[model samples]
Target: MRQIPTLAPLPARLPDSVPFVGPETLERQRGAPFAARLGANENGFGPSPRAIAAMQAEAGEVWKYGDPTNHDLRAAIAAHCGVTPAHVVVGEGIDTLLGLAVRLMVAQGDRVVSSEGGYPTFDFHVTGFGGELLRVPYRDDRQDPQALVARAVEIGARMVYLCNPDNPMGGWHPPEVIEAALAALPDDILLILDEAYAEFAPALPRIDPDDPRVLRMRTFSKAHGMAGARIGWAIGAPVMIRAFDRVRNHFGVNRIAQAGALAALADTAHLDRTVAQVAAARDRIAAIARDNGLTTLPSATNFVAVDCGGDGDFARAVLTALGDRGVFVRMPWVAPQNRCIRVSCGPAGALDAFAEALPHALAMARQGASGG
Candidate 1:
């Protein structure tokens, strides 16, 4: 046999697993299409009509590479965020941008901090870069910012990651709390704030695009309903933003995605409608949980975490039963929080399917728990 080149020392030790398994992969494994897809926290309400029109219009132009500079989109984002283009860097998605950020700051064995069971993608990036990832536990279902900062300081961590209006738990801290966390953090420690669900949040902390200590990441995937488009941006001080150009995949963002995101940004009416629909869906999800004698955690995101009144295994059993019934939903991976199942907001019909399947799924899970 021909000899093959050995993998790099860092990558050779890492597991061959992705941060998340896509719903498509799950469907392939299950050998059936799900009747409802609410597990991914995707905006099932879909992208704005204007965005769709723009993408369709740009389809013929797929022959050309997207602007290597991402100039026009960055300009639009800068105007929207009240920052100059130099302070913004566009990338394939927050996931790619997270990887770039990690590469920029995390040296081998350097300490980085994030909440236990927080956004796993960030963790993946940190580990991939051979950085030492230190995790702080969530307090009261929200990321304990104080604990995160304290741990980072204690270890002299190079970076800290926090997700606002958090995922898989759907809790949020007030603006003051976030600002206080920023104030308490040392200037040397870079904070990576993943604001993927920012659009659905009721309130947000004011952004200082000139702040060197923080990088705020936002995505078109959630609120813009452009998950498939795979576009996002990060805002930081001009110096930090400029550094990304050295390592980022310059032509990675597709032309269609750029066109779609640009149009979506301009269509404020569509965004407002989607936000309203998400709020209504959140309330409906809570009602469904109540009807099943379970409870939902308060959410400022487009998803709700419903307490299954059991432990991780029980919630997992419920999740399996839901999957068996062609309803796709997810639960937290770690305990205490794992007692809840996460349901993404969608149109009425999808929620109806979930509402229809839940009671039976709970019955099956209970029966399995009883060893029947």
Candidate 2:
């Protein structure tokens, strides 16, 4: 018999889990590729032409490492935010930045606060770093900001996470509510404010950069339509920003991605156009759901959550039927919220596939319920 080395206590104790299964993995399992890809909240409109051009131009420079300091990109992000480069930290993406925040702020057994079925990746990060997670349930399908603050204080938490224009449910609170949450949070607890979908939701409020306890995360992945580029940045007080450097991968941001993200940031017209396209696609999705007798929640992000008019089992059956019919979509992992299936905005062709698939999927779900 062969012997293997043992993992450390934290890694060993943790179960093998992933935040989501990729579409490719699903295709492999089903022995077919999906006709419409809409599950992951990715922007299907794609990145700006200018950004694509910049990445193509920089393709030859892939032989060299990206700027370790991420100087120019950080400067551009700072300029956009009306802050200095010292307050910006560029990373591979918000996912990596989230992990970094967990590592730096959370020691083993420290308490962290988040929504019950919030962005699962953040929860994965917290647990991976050995932090104890306390979750507050959604109030009226939206994250209850006051409840989050109260939990943080009651538990003496080290960090709190809030996703503005949230995922899965696509619900958001007005800026004043977030401001109140910030005020209510204890001084020592850091608020990791994720604004990845901010471009699609104009009504949401942006926080002041001067606040030391708040770190706002932004991404080129959503409105800028550079998900493949894998680039994002965090804006916070200078001291908090610098702490990321201590544990972050020094050369993590690829050269081509940096070039693409910089160009994307410069092209405001492209961003505005993309946002409009997403809004239209969102409306189309809602209309299709209504046509099929399903209602949709108001969406601030690039996706809409369609209420299945049933329980979690019913929604799961609908999602499975969609998969079987070559349409890829997702749903929330927990109850009340899990009763809705999430659909991402895409080109007319993709949504057409979805529109074609929904009626058949509904039929299958209903039939299964009757034991047919």
Worst 10 residues of 2 by lDDT: 201-210
The all-Cα superposition gives candidate 2 an RMSD in Å to the true structure of 0.9
**Residue 215 lDDT, candidate 1, scale 0-100:** 97
Output the number of the lDDT-best candidate: 1
TM-score of candidate 1 on Cα atoms, chains taken together: 0.99
**Candidate 2, residues 19-129: lDDT per residue as tens digits?**
989999999999999999999888889999999999999999899999999999999999998999999999999999999999999999999999999999999999999
Model 1 alpha-carbon drift over 4 Å, by segment: none
RMSD list, candidates in order: 0.8, 0.9
lDDT of each: 0.94, 0.92
Clashes of 1: 0
**Cα-lDDT of candidate 2:** 0.92
